[model samples]
Target: MKYLRKLVIGATCLVSMAASAQWQWTDKDGRKVYSDRAPPSDILDKNILKRPAGRVNPLVTNEASLNAASPVAAASSPHGSASAPKLSGVDKELAEKKKKAEEAEVAKRKAEEERVAKSKIENCARAKQAKTNFDSGIRIARTNEKGEREIMDDATRSAEAKRIQFIIDSDCK
Candidate 1:
């Protein structure tokens, strides 16, 4: 009976020591958390003493620990897939920005094309005006030439020739 009492006392002391060493903390989400180390100073008021969850016997199943030790190895094994899924974070943003830039460039090119078309139209109008002025000048010179040839008298012809020469010098030149 004395040996059994001593064993019970030893077991109680070991349990008390284990309970005293663990520090407890509560996260911002109000979830209870316990660790071997003390929590940060910001969460001092939320700390509370509580019993831990049931402990798993490592001898029975160490598969969880084994997978945690090398997660990459487990993923690459038979359980892994042929390829991982694609993520769309920064690449998606860059693609959208590139599309916007291309659209802006296309708009700018269209505006430039409109400006060029307007300039071509104005140049064509100016060329047409120049051609009309040239044709009018030729008609006036031909009329003066015909008037001089129709004059039979030499003095009248000479006077008309002088007038035609003056008209040509003033208007045609």
Candidate 2:
């Protein structure tokens, strides 16, 4: 009974294995193709590449092995030799707009930097001129906020000179 059971089990295994034949061939487009059914008689002899045993197809097995051998190819072709994703019309337009916006932002920032630099240079020049006038003892007068003409005293002039000097020191650098 034991020997008979072993024989039956081995025959069943052989029959299951025979039922899972796979045929591989190159299609008219030159791409490798895999199928469970046999190719047509006209193209079978010329295009047939592999007749792999068991259930796993040769095309899939070869692709897996190829991917494992070269990781770069696998990264680029996740679904085997299919082409990369193409950008649609809307995506292309969005990409272009994003690039233009980035350029505009950079230009605006540069223009702002230039304007600030020019303002600092003008401030430094005015501060230096004011300090020179105070040093020469030139009597500087100004109309007050109340519309009264007021002459600066010596102490006031000295304080103004010190303030202008501070401005020059801060902006000239």
Candidate 3:
């Protein structure tokens, strides 16, 4: 039981040590940076606010050369001051992709409308032909539910003609 308790205590201590291994520093941009590893080599040791246990401070002792203390000053000029991070507008490639997607959507909608219009035109032509068949007084045969060939009588012909005429009225324009 004592050995088990000792093992648990040792494990807890190890976990706590690992948790304290994080690095905390303030970047030139005034942003507080936190990471598991050390900051970039360009970052001066003075900028580091916190370091893991047993880590040596590399703060430059020589006051004679300010330039030797900070290499970041040189890199800072060509790229704007790191104190203010540049905010960029929307990416050009992303904007183009969005534009293409919108155009594709418009084209898809146009194609769908054209398909529906073609279907309506075909329906109108078929309805007009049916109307002509009924007006000509020719006998028309249809398949009944019993699978038998049945001749359309006057009443049936009139009803079918009315239905066809309704299709023509709705679609012919």
Candidate 4:
């Protein structure tokens, strides 16, 4: 019996405490204001915004109330239903396009690298053959601009061999 009495007294106190919260007058800026205590006696009743049940803060307008007040405004809100349905399709298409573009770029880069590697291998092979001919004391001949075959001299052969060795060092790496 004593426990039930204490529980009832506690429940009454909680109910009264919650009921004490109320919406007061709007400020000078026209924004609604809420308070746990009643407005001063000097304030007019007309300025009072609302006396919501429970402990709802009247100054903070919830989504349900805003949607109830204006259907058009609710439809245009970011969290509204209008834009939600179309987002999935648009996002998927955009993601697919972005992925394809990235894949194409990677393929182009790989093809270019392969071409460069083939060119380097060809150059290294030619340079190595020229170096071997130079080491064998073979008389290297070149076609001059006038289309005449000119046999390379010892000095010219030495310079050509040095140049070929340099090419081999650079390209074989």
Whole-model lDDT values for every prediction = 0.59, 0.78, 0.80, 0.78
Model 4 per-residue lDDT tens digits across residues 61-151:
5667757867875785546566655555467778899999999999999999999999999999999998999999877899999999999
Task: Work out candidate 2's RMSD over C-alphas.
Answer: 15.2
| Per-model tally of clashing residue pairs | 0, 0, 0, 0
CA deviation > 4 Å runs, candidate 3: 1-69, 73-87
Can you give the TM-score per candidate against the true fold?
0.33, 0.47, 0.54, 0.54
Give the CA lDDT, 0 to 100, for residue 23 in model 3: 85
What TM-score should be assigned to candidate 2?
0.47
Report the lDDT tens digits of candidate 3 across residue range 1-173.
99999999999999878867878788989898978899999888788877887342445223324345467643443243466557587788999999999999999999999999999999999998888888898899999999999999889888998899999999999
Stretches of model 1 off by over 4 angstroms after superposition: 1-90, 138-173
Q: Compared with the true structure, what per-residue lDDT tens digits does model 2 show for residues 47-87?
A: 67766574333334556665786777565553565576654
Off by over 4 Å in 2: 1-90
Better of 2 and 3 by TM-score: 3
Per-residue accuracy of model 1 over 76-140 as CA lDDT, tens digit each: 43324356654545687789999999999999999999997777666656555544544454322
